[model samples]
Target: METLLINEQFVSQFKYWREGQVRTGMRFRRNLFEYVSKFNHHQRHHAFDLAWKLAQAGKESIVTATSDSYTIWVNLRVVCPAALPSWSNSGLEVGAFEPASPGLVPLEAVLSA
Candidate 1:
């Protein structure tokens, strides 16, 4: 998810958010679906962990931690993908090294950036 976050930020001024199917087989309806569907297992794990924590806290709106924060919207990731792929369709795991890093990021950090 970190790579994805960076990728998205890197691609930020491009408006590629409206990006359509790279091929003829996939026709994504929403930008958020397209965005999250790209995350790998580690990313998904991190995302689910975050979502679970948010839901557990009784935060009714799962959009962004901040009301005006446009960084990410939870509803998009939570309910959009037609089928979640391993990682941005790249099929790469979050940690390929011998010792994997922790999967979860603090909510404060996620919300901060």
Candidate 2:
């Protein structure tokens, strides 16, 4: 499993984006780049970069968004196990896995147990 932690700063920017879209008469965009910038920008972060890359490569991920933060967990083992160690070394915290929804066990949690 590869985890990406999006800090509160990003969430604020995301809310701004949503409001901007509404004001511009554009439907709220769901593009990954919109939420997490890939180019140089104030909202850019390493976590966003990794998440974007994984998403582009068609890796499966679960996203959990809250007012405090946004978290993404990529199931790299099924598609690219060798890449796991590199992601693990990227300074992301390894916290207790929290299921994206109630009563659902993330595969990583099950395997780790």
Candidate 3:
């Protein structure tokens, strides 16, 4: 019964905490589901190892340890079509747009200058 509870907890965590992969149909989700189905909670301590395997295969990803409550290791990776925008000089500035402020500058004015 304890193992079942653990498995339930793991599934819940994976479903919600890792929703992105599951929703997007990423390979990681399938791999993890298979792992969970094949092994009990006691034998499923390879989240980091699996992440490492992905990274070693030349995939751009990230891995990190999860909260201490459950498993010792948890990894998260997100793959997008384009990580950044291709457009250059989009006239986006970090500071506020308050015209009254002397030092403040609007991106539009800067771009036009």
Per-candidate Cα lDDT values, in order, are: 0.29, 0.37, 0.27
Which residue pairs does candidate 1 place in steric collision?
Answer: 38-88, 39-87, 39-88, 40-86, 40-87
Candidate 1 structure, TM-score to reference: 0.22
lDDT of 1: 0.29
lDDT of 3 by residue, 1-113 (tens): 00111322223222222223221111233232111111223333443344344445444432222232122112223233242122111332122111222342332333243
- Displacement of residue 74 (Cα, Å) in model 1 is 4.9
Per-candidate TM-score against the hidden true structure: 0.22, 0.36, 0.23
> Residue 48 error for model 2, in Å?
2.3
Stretches > 4 Å off in candidate 3 = 1-45, 69-113
Q: For residues 48-100, could you state the per-residue lDDT of candidate 2 as single tens digits?
A: 66676666777644343445344445542344435544543233443433323
Give stretches of model 2 more than 4 Å off. Answer: 1-44, 75-78, 94-113
Best by the lDDT measure: 2
For model 2, what is the C-alpha lDDT against the true structure? Answer: 0.37
The TM-score of candidate 2 is: 0.36
- Please provide, for model 1 over 24-48, each residue's C-alpha lDDT reduced to its tens digit, 9 standing for 90 to 100: 1111222322223222433555444
| Between candidates 1 and 2, the TM-score winner | 2
